[model samples]
Target: MSTLYLLHKPYRMLSQFTDKQGRATLADVITVPDVYAAGRLDYDSEGLLLLSDDGELIHRISHPRHKQPKTYWVQVEGDISEAALKSLRQGITLKDGPTQPAKARQIAPPASAPRQPPIDPKRHPSTSWLELTISEGRNRQVRRMTAHVGFPTLRLIRTAIGPWQLDGLAPGEWRTETLHAPRPTDKHPNRRKAPRKDQRARPAAKHRKP
Candidate 1:
């Protein structure tokens, strides 16, 4: 069995357990030993993060090759034009390359608690909320994509990762659950031959025969 935990990580907290600079880290919130974050949420961003002690499970969740979808609620510094939304859905070009098609749409402000240092309205007068889901995890991909569309992301929060969600979770809160599915097994290319009835090991001749 593996240990899995879902946490609502607050903004400005390091994803790892330690930071030499005395900054806040997961250790400050969770006390579980041997568990590590499956995927990372940047220190500047906040929301659902999965942790586990199982290496294979962690790879399944975090590896880009698996194509697990991650959903984020982003607040950008613009009114967010239709063209911009279309661009995101169609895939935005970044310095690395063109991104995969993403699911994006306008959304009302989330009902979550305000950020510790609330986004200063004076800094970004007009802002819009957008829900974007992407399968690929690039470094700062969401922020870069939004910026590519001419709307800088003011605040970003991941709400979902694959089948798990952050429902009812408050900042710095965590919950553990057993993995419902069986662990992944190695694939065998060649089929094994079954034993014939005569070849199979049979119970010793009945002693009753004597």
Candidate 2:
């Protein structure tokens, strides 16, 4: 049985346990030994972050190939247009490459926890909320995608990652849960083996240097 921690990472804090730049880190919040963050969030971003002692579980959660869905509450500047929402659903190209299609929709402002310092509304007088769910973990992908469609992300908070949700966790709080999901192994279970008949090769090709 592996232990997993559901942490509510506060805004402007690093996902790591230690930081050389004197910025706040998980050490300031969580004290569990031997548990490392399964995936990470940007220093400016907030919300659900998972930590686990199981490397396989971490790999399963973080690897893009797994296509584990992660959903966020995005606050973007200006009213997000339907055209933008359509493009987000269909997918958009970023500097790295094209992003996978995502679930994006305009939503009423979520009654989320207030930021530590609180976001300044004056910087962007007009803003709206969006619920965006994506499977790929690209560098600043949600922000880039929204910007490409003419709306820049003002704030981001991951609400859920696969089966884990941020529900009931306040800022700087954490809860532990033991996960038992078929016990992932390091072996490649999907590799195909050569057929027995194919393994028996011909003596030689007919026209070779006999």
Candidate 3:
């Protein structure tokens, strides 16, 4: 059986287990071994992060092609207009590539606990909060998407990832959950089948020229 951990990562903590500068990491909080993060959360962002001991489970959870929804509570620098929300839903093009169409909507203020250091006050006397849910997990994606639409995000907190949520978990805390075997219909057709358990654990190394 595989082990799945749902971690509520606090702001300013590295996602990986190790940091050369002695910053906080999962290793500092989680005592489990051989578990790896399914996806990444930026050091400045706070919220749910999933980890698992099974490599196949990791890929299934975080791979963009799987189309798992990730919901973020974003506080932006200016009042978000209806046009901005529409643009986000239609999908804003980023420098790297066009984002997949997303579900963007203004939300009532969330009931999350206060951050240790609150978001900075807007210099221009404008700010708003909105909820954004996207299936793709691009690097700093929620921040970039909002900025592209002229409402730069001031603070970002991920509220959920797929079926997992940050409901009872507090900042910097973690809990484990049992994941059921994927049903035949639940698996993504595009994803290649994972190697059998008896196969070599390591993926084939790619050759790079010096």
Which structure among the candidates has the greatest lDDT?
A: 1
TM-score of each: 0.86, 0.86, 0.83
Q: 133, model 1: CA deviation in Å? A: 0.1
Candidate 3 positional error at 114, Å: 1.6
Error of 3 at 131 (Å): 0.9
Error (Å) of candidate 1 at residue 97 is 0.4
Model 1 Cα lDDT, one tens digit per residue, 1-210: 666789999999988887779988887777766667877899999999997766667766666555788999999998998899999999978999999999999999989868999999898889999999999999999999999999999999999998889997899988887886633332331322332232221232321110
Which 10 consecutive residues of model 1 have the lowest summed lDDT?
Answer: 201-210
Candidate 2: tens digits of C-alpha lDDT, residues 1-210? 777788899999988876668998877777665667766899999999987666567766666566789999999999999999999999988889888899999999998888778668788889999999999998888999999999999899999998789996888888888867533343543432222221122232231210
Runs in model 1 lying further than 4 Å from the true structure: 183-210
User: What 10-residue stretch in candidate 2 is worst by lDDT?
Assistant: 201-210
Model 3 bad stretches (over 4 Å):
122-125, 183-210
Using alpha carbons, what is the TM-score of model 3?
0.83
lDDT of each: 0.81, 0.80, 0.77
Q: Return the TM-score for candidate 2, rounded to 2 decimals.
A: 0.86
Q: Quickly count the clashes in candidate 3.
A: 0
